[model samples]
Target chain A: MILIEGKDITLGYEGQGIISGLSFSVEDGDYLCIVGENGSGKSTFVKTVLGLVEPLKGTISYRGGLKKNEIGYLPQQSGIQRDFPSSVLEVVLSGCLNRRKRLFGYTADEKKKALLELERLGMNRERNASFQELSGGQQQRVLLARALMATEKLIFLDEPVTGLDPKTSSELYEIVDELNRGGITIMMVTHDIHPALNDARTILHLSQGRYFFGSKEEYFRSDLGRMFMKEAGHDHH
Target chain B: MIITEILSYPFLVRALLVGILVSVSASLLGVSLVLRRFSMIGDGLSHVGFGALGVAAFLSLPPMAVTVPVVIAAAVVLLHLSSRRKGGGDSAIALISSSALAIGVIAVSAAGVNTDLNAFLFGSILSVSRSDAVVSLLISAVTLFSYSVFYHQIYATTFDPAFATATGIKTERYTALLSLLTALVIVVGMRILGSLLISSLIIFPSAVAMKLGKSYLSVSLIAAAESLIAFVLGFVSSYVFSLPTGASIVLVHLIIFALSVCLRHSIIVFRSHREMI
Candidate 1:
């Protein structure tokens, strides 16, 4: 099923469009990776799709009109955000903030779900630890766990692996892949193209308000793909 | 003992009640401010409240009535202007803070209301009235009730506005509410802690609690406890030593913050040495 569809979307801040005439769609369980250099509107696109920024032109249609609470998002790493005075469990539990019927408290099932999500991420040991004390990779995992506390149907991750060791990045990707296999649609923005190309079924190449979306194999075989690979250095692969 | 003397006085009892009530609200909001890196907003708004006080005195109106609305208005302006610029939070607070202080100083100087400047700049716990104590309790109650009822929404907005918006939480409304609550606390606390020292009461305890790495629930409790302790000690010390009440309270808070820093540093050093060994 098509979960998200953006048709001729124009996105930017305060009506100054950074990226325009963009179109894309994500199916159930599809893993879409967006890759580009800095200021390539990757984050802007994510923000627009997540409804943080209003589209300058087009409409974003969701399948069967899913509630806002159903979409999970993982933003890029912010150093200050890591040091927020919250426990791993508390932070993860906050993902269910929108799901609670009452304005203040959480239900027993919500608490259980939060714990289960932390356990699922193998972060049960650090559940009681302050979020600032976690390693970068661990922080990402905790964020991922928090995202999972909402619906697992559609997940938008912006720059999910910007600052991590190679081993940790690969491990995080493995977890992403596992989630994707479990029927959650994944849209990730990443600078590391090698591992993403291997994992993603679709690639959206954004450059200066233009986007080329298609199969990963087609993107790699294109001239732009060759230039990107050459510029980024093929050695990392 | 000094405790008996303080307990025997009605004004002292009023001061104690006002102190505890305001401490609860200030400490709770302090946690959010510290997290947002705008702890100085309390100081800024308190100065703005001073301007409001000058205006109230010149108009011969109740200071609380005039100050509360003016501070709330300033908070709204602060939040709106800050939201317009990229990374404008800290700069907005700093700008408003300086201008408000300057305006207050000018207003008070021009009006020549024969008011005791020291009483406004430095608090006098002995001046606390039954009516003022009642007002403080009411504002604190409202602040606490609003926060408890809207905690999830506030939590989501503060932690990540984008995610909160995605989840259909109205971020702007909550931000406005936070600012309003902050203004209310500033107005009520201005009398007990003084304009200059109220910000310390709002900030220092939270900073200490954060240093201790306590959970949010525990942080609020500990910050309130710290403030209460500082208030009791400052009140007693001011009486015993004939010192300035507001300055004494602020000094006590500063001492606690300094101690927390030293304790944190020592723990870090101890851990490093243990790891090296």
Candidate 2:
């Protein structure tokens, strides 16, 4: 049931390695939350898996009949990307672009699916609203809906709740948890590690030069885990 | 009757035809360029086209043919420079634009083509030959067709290039294709809008449309319509007032852009007032 496997991957940009010798495997229906301090290359790892960046070393393979394009991805939004001129519906529908084989346009079914995903994200009312005009939480939800249109099998979310209030962040996590419960594999990199670790079956704690990849309980007992928990202040809330 | 008499002139008819066609193409592609903050690229490529036109005139060769490939080459170079370095887009554009303009000025002086230079820089719509009109029509058609066929991909890339690439779109190829098409459009369009003002045709309509339209598709359509209206009005006004055609078209776009901004502000104010009531 291994959906994706990465071994000794050294992810980086422009011939320089950011995080080296990182190995991880994502199983079908598994919720893996990647946690780390800043500059631990959490986003880099996500990009490598999504094929946006190649590993400077090692291998990444997709099993379980998963195509690279079939893996939905929600990238971390920059300020410029947030101000992109597009509507909520158009943004979501564009996710289906990778799924298409033809060059004409989105099919009726694709449009319906995009609409449905918007509704599912509780954004149907804002479907025609400009994406730039949306609040941070709403923008993340729209992006999630876009990822949904890309694939139902697996999703990779990079700090989906980076700039939201605590309440909105928890609500976003609830949606992600629901997605996991519905049999989708999730690999999310998050700064809010406590809630993520609570819902995640697997915890990946990446630090400089090394990483820990195991079940949640095993992660709690590791030295890196103790350090992280201490730094994150051991409150399981 | 006077309008019909004016339209009866072959040169004027050709100018209008080519002008409208170029406007539509420029506006459609403008949305993508402006949204991506690469609007100045059109200006840069047009300058390159101006330089190529000067070189062609110096050599007694066909200007459009030389201009098209030269602008395309410049586009490719700019694309490469921008991609190779971070925050290089504007710098690359500035470098190419200034260099091209300098080369053009020198070429015009060296070849004593000041009259031809003025026509290319400011645009003499009355000078649009039959052959030039045919080429302009064909290039405009290709630009529009390419935009139509790759509309979705362009949309994805323009909105978020990294996400588009992650979703298995060949973003680089599509971006390069867009640059080439923009180059072609600018080269052909320089005949009507002039190199100095051609980028305005690509920048103004899109900027104006974004203020009024809610989505990319709607904005593109609005931009094209705005470009057409501006072009026709500008052409007519220039004919009546005996003004420079290219500057006249750009002036019309500026007025329309101002109007769109006012209209958008008025709607917001009206909605807020109603809410207060």
Candidate 3:
């Protein structure tokens, strides 16, 4: 089943063309990694696919009975997030916002689900802790918990492991892999070409003026993927 | 006895009621404003309110009627600039704020000496009429109601706007609504703390509370409590010492902010020491 498909998509901001005529599709439970360098339109493409950014031109249709709230997103950390005053539980609860219709607060079931999501991410102990006080890895886990609360089918992660220590990022990668194995389509975007990222079953390698989206094996067979692979040096996980 | 004597005055009672209501709303809005780095927008809107008041005064029209719409518009502009920002958000506010202040001063001077001029600049809570109190009460009630109704959405927007946007929350609309509420709160609060000192209500309480409180809800409640405390203490002290009500309230906030900082330092030190043991 096609979960997300974009046809002839053009992504940009304020008349500046970032990626033009890019088309891609994701199947149910597929693990896709978007790899590119800086200015390669990777993040923009992911944001557009997630309906965060308005594509300069494209039709991104979500199919296979996916509701808006069923698609989770873990965005890149921003500077403002460093000092934002919030509780971990509150941050996670916000993920259920679209699922919420009551003006008062989250429903009992939603609150319970949010707690469960935190526990799943190993952040239940920090649920009441101040979000700003958490370490980098802990914050990411809390956000992952948040994204989990938002979706049960698909998750869009924009550099979930950036700015983390190697151990922490690897742990996060394992968790993401587990999530993918559990039948959730994962769209992970990263700038660097790392060994762990190679776990992606599909690689969408974006570069200036061109992009390649295909099976992981085919990506390695392609010249663009081979050049990137040679540059990153194939090695052990 | 002095408290009773002060409370006996219906005008003072009206001022007190209005002050408490406005403080609660202002401080609640303050938490998000300060966290989102738009604290100065409160001050900016206050200047716009002042300028609107001057224009109203010059035209011999009611001030609130003129100030509310103009300040709200200014807030939208500030938020728009901040959204598309390349670091010019602050400067845009500064430019608009200073110009509005200048316009207000000039308009007030040109309009001939009106008794409302001093009140507009530094605030004169004593002059709050029965109708003015009622209007302020309604506006404050509206602000509080809206804040509570959109509490989670506001929290989501301020904490992570991109995440909020992606989740189908109309973050831009909430951002505008936030600024709109801040504008109304400012207009209503200017009478209590004056246009010049009103922004302290929006910036100080949240700044102090965020350090001491553990969670978002705690911080909001603490900020509200702190602002209300400052307003009441400043009101009573202003009566006793013959000080300006706005200045008295600001001074109390300043003291509270300073004390909280010192207490927070000790708490941090104590916690770290215990952790080591």
Could you give the candidate ranking by DockQ, starting with the highest?
A: 2, 3, 1
Candidate 2, B101-154: lDDT as tens digits: 888888777888344778879877788888888888998999989999999999
Error of 1 at B42 (Å): 1.2
Error of 1 at A185 (Å): 1.3
Q: Comparing to the true complex, what docking class would candidate 3 get?
A: medium
Where does candidate 3 clash, by residue pair? none
Candidate 2 local distance difference test against the native: 0.87
Q: In model 1, which regions exceed 4 Å deviation?
A: A234-237, B82-92, B269-277
Docking class of 1: medium
**Model 2 spans with C-alpha error above 4 angstroms:** A18-20, A235-237, B83-87, B113-115
Local accuracy of candidate 2 as per-residue lDDT tens digits, A1-237: 999999988888788887787888999999998999888888778778888778999999999999988888888887236556688999999998986877797888999999999988899999999999999889999999999999989989888887789999999899999989999999898888666557999999888878899999999888898888878788463
Pairs that collide in candidate 1 are none
TM-score of chain A of each: 0.93, 0.93, 0.92
DockQ of candidates 1 onward, in order? 0.55, 0.69, 0.69
DockQ: which is higher, 1 or 3?
Answer: 3
Local accuracy of candidate 1 as per-residue lDDT tens digits, A1-237:
788889998878787887788888888889999888888888778877877777899999888555545788887776236666778887888787767787657888988988898888899999898887889999899888888887778888888888899999999999999989888889898888865567899988888767778888898887667668888876345
lDDT for B67 (candidate 1): 89
TM-score of the second chain, each candidate in turn, equals: 0.92, 0.95, 0.97
